[model samples]
Target: MKRIPYMLLLASLLLNIYSAAVWGFACYAHSGVAERSTYYRQFTAGSDPRTFSVGAFTVTLLSLIVFIAAVRKLRGWYIAVAIVQALFALLYVWQLS
Candidate 1:
């Protein structure tokens, strides 16, 4: 029960990393338009990059909220997590642009 928030944070981190990898591959690979499109669709499970970014943002936000609401102590740790999540969200936005 107490571990759920932490688990959510971990999940969000992994999600962002995976999305970054997918986006990077889609951008850097020297492939045909059709091939890139197909790879993007397959990597993102049929959803586009924008949609995936939004979902990742939502999960990061949810994890922060859950951590704040569930944990009574660890203020410093929470702040660190919040900072990392914020940076990730910013990176996602940058990638989309």
Candidate 2:
């Protein structure tokens, strides 16, 4: 069977990691302290912010693992992963906007 290209796998993995990090940061910064200013509010978390971030990180990691495993057996799945990565990138941009 033809193997998937290494560069595609690498690109997907990097994009997945980047998405997870961006999502995790958003999760971590969900809540804000009352005393802190708007600019500094996101940095402070009094309540449990880990719950969301950890969940996001775990889901992203698991998806990446599943994608890697599937891509090994079935070629061309990387295209799907790349599309997903692109969507994630778009989501990141949307967040910034």
Q: Write the per-residue lDDT of candidate 2 for residues 1-97, one digit (tens) a residue.
A: 2234445456555645654564456556645533223322343342233343343344444555555565645447666765665465455444444
Candidate 1 error regions (>4 Å)? 30-38, 73-79, 95-97
Q: What does candidate 1's lDDT look like per residue over 16-47, in tens digits?
A: 77877876797788467666666778888898
Q: Where does candidate 1 have its weakest 10-residue lDDT segment?
A: 30-39
Q: Rate the local accuracy (lDDT) of all candidates.
A: 0.78, 0.49
Badly placed stretches (over 4 Å) of model 2 are: 1-5, 8-12, 18-22, 25-30, 33-75
lDDT (Cα) of model 1: 0.78
Clashes of each: 0, 0
Q: How high is each candidate's TM-score?
A: 0.74, 0.35
| Clashing residue pairs in candidate 2 (N, C-alpha, C atoms within 3 angstroms) | none
